[model samples]
Target chain A: MVMPMDGQLLVLAQAETGNALGETAPTIEVEEVGEPNPLTADEQELHATTEADGDAHHSDVFPPFDATTFGDQLLWLAICFAFLYVVMSRMALPRIGGILEQRKARIEGDLAAADYSRKKTDAAIAAYEAALAEARAKAQAMAEETRTSIKADIDGKRAQVEQDLARKLEDAEARIAATKAQALANVDEIAADTVQALVGQLTGEVSQAEAREAVSQVSKE
Target chain B: MADPNTVDPIHQFAIYDIFTLGDTGISFSNSSLFMVLTVGTIAAWLLLSTAGRKIIPNRAQAASEMLYEFVANMVRGAAGTEGMKFFPFVFSLFMFVLVANYFGMVPYFFTVTSHIIVTFALAMLVMVVVIGYGFARHGVKFLKLFVPAGVPGYVLPIVVPIEVISFLSRPVSLSVRLFGNMLAGHITLKVFAGFVVTLGSLGFLGVLGAVLPLIMAVALTALEFMVSTVQAYVFAVLASMYLNDAVHPSH
Candidate 1:
């Protein structure tokens, strides 16, 4: 029986007191302490003498069939275990669980917010690209319209300038023609006078009609 | 110098009554004191660590959270998600056993787990929970746990009794494994320590001889610490396994 035999158990109880002295004394004191509790000094001596006879004490830790302390140990164990269980299940574990849940929820919420913000950024980029394309198209159309309008304005100005130049040329040509005809008439009169002088000098019988007819024929040619 | 033979290696495991109830035989003993201390320390450490409840945990909080997650993962792995319902029980058992085992390593302190009675009680609690939950959840079908699937019906008579005995022995095996490991380790440590004191007393050569045992004691102490932690982990893992069996009786 793994009985907490009085002798063995007393040795345990006196261990602290045994520590007070030198190491050697403590070891010897431990044996004496075990004997003193169960019997008077006289019986202890008898028992010590028996122990000294080298009969090994029934010191097997797991001695056969000892039921003495089982009741008290079981009772205490149940009490302690119950207390521990209640505290753990009711209070401690739930708190940790709640904290973990909170952390998980917080992480999920942050991820969701990140996802939402990312989507908003994508939408904004898309809108910006659309606006940029529309602005490019509008600028292109305005440039085409401006180029056509400017080309038309230049064409109209060129046409009007050409017409004005043609009119000026025609007027100048008519004036020049008139001047030539007047000069031709004067030349005929002078020629007639000159021819009559020359003829008188050369052959003193030239007629006025002959000079006029020569001048007229030359003018006609 | 004290005689070396006087040092009792088993002295540390003895229980002493600090205060006794009148005629009831029920008393507050050293074992009870350490048990209370173990629970109190666990409670205080966990509560204080989590008091701030910050999203970003502080050092103390981080340590506590690590332990929590470790045990949590252990349950989830062994028992699956459904087994998580019993997290509190498993966590409590793990922490209590772990704390008690480590606390035993402190010089002159009592080891609550070293006692067979205490370990047996804890084991019984696990067995009770497993059986109770199994029946509660599965009803008569829980008996199917003992009957292996795809077995010849002729083998039922032989296998059923063996399965029942194994099932019944779970608590015994569980309790004894922890108790035996702790008891043996502590005894071995005490015996080696006794060698240190005895050898040192034998004069010059004796002191030289003491060094070897001292070194071995140090090495064994390190081993014991590992054993303590591993045993606690094993206890929790086994409990979770049993709970898994309970939750899924068909397997």
Candidate 2:
């Protein structure tokens, strides 16, 4: 029975200790003996020890709530925070803000410059293309002019050669006509001579005039 | 059972004086040291990083610029373009709280924002600015913030008081939110870390069992870091929203 009672006391003590500090142990003897009157002298002594420990622990106020530290904390907080506020507002913040502002301005300026450069480049390219197109058109016109002039020169030379050849052909036709008329006249004279020779050889000498007259009459018939 | 002496979680929050001014009750303490460090760090980071003022920023300059733009955009988004007048004030508050919270994350370093007085003062400062700016800018028209435009006339009484109450509780909530987060997060981390120490003392078996708590402590440390950053951002966002009321108090 005594052993069981001791076991119960140990269990109660352990339970209380565990509640105070979320860990279990058998070492905290009789932390809060619920029934003080039923306690043995040994249990009472253990309770006294536990009470002393609790007093020692609670003697100092919880540090967060300690009124004595309030003045110091408030003073330092004011000094540090005010100093920080002033430094930040007056010096540090403005500097950072300025840096950011400058960076933004620089970026914008660079972008604007880039945009201007791009526009200039576009204009230059457009100008170059325009000049190239104008040059191409000029070259086409010059080539057409050159070809027209060359064709006119060739046509003029061909017309002169054709006129010379036609004149030469007409002159040759006139000469052939003249030659034919001369040959016809010679043929009449030669016929008269042949008839006169035949008459002289066959029927006694006849008059040349009379043979010519007969031949002429035969040609007319 | 853990030894109470070895696992006293609240010991870390204690403030001890480094030097005290004679009889005036003003003393330099650990909290003061951290506050100074916080301000110094912010100043140096902002000032030194941007000293070059390069058109293209280096890594440090970019980081500083990002912090500036982040807070700037938040103020603008919450309050609008007219609220740019309060940019410096909002920036200061954001940096101080953010750097102080991060400073607290370093081991063995005091957390300036974990104290209720410090956060309360900051919240009050914000409220004062809001009220002062609202009244200065709009006169009695600032009271229009409490009166909703679309509310039916019969429900004005109930709705107005509720708005007034919520408006009055802003500083309390603001201060407590940051303080509580910092205090509770630090306490939780300390408690979990204490478990590892307490469990690791029992011998080879205890060492093996301690691994679980050790893992928990590491995870909690990561959670605490997130909590610190998030609390700082929340504080800044809320302050911006409140400042918006000063700029446009017509609900």
lDDT of 2 by residue, A101-194 (tens): 9999999999999999999999999999999999999999999999999999999998999988888888888888888888877777788888
Runs off by more than 4 Å, candidate 2: A1-59, A195-221, B1-5
Q: What shift in Å separates residue A160 of candidate 2 from its native position after superposition?
A: 0.9
Q: Model 1: runs farther than 4 Å from truth?
A: A1-66, A173-221, B1-5
Error of 2 at B223 (Å): 0.9
Compared with the true structure, what per-residue lDDT tens digits does model 2 show for residues B143-194? 9999999999999999999999999999999999999999999988888778
- Provide the lDDT at B186 for model 2: 92
Model 1 residue B229 distance off true place after TM-score fit, in angstroms: 1.3
Candidate 2 chain B lDDT trough over 10 residues, lowest sum: B1-10
Q: Give the C-alpha lDDT of model 2.
A: 0.81
Docking class of 2: acceptable
> Model 1 chain B: which ten-residue window has the lowest total lDDT?
B16-25
The superposed Cα distance between candidate 1 and the true structure at residue A7, in angstroms, equals 18
TM-score of chain B of 2: 0.96
Per-candidate clash tally:
4, 2
Error of 2 at A20 (Å): 36
Say which candidate scores most in lDDT.
2
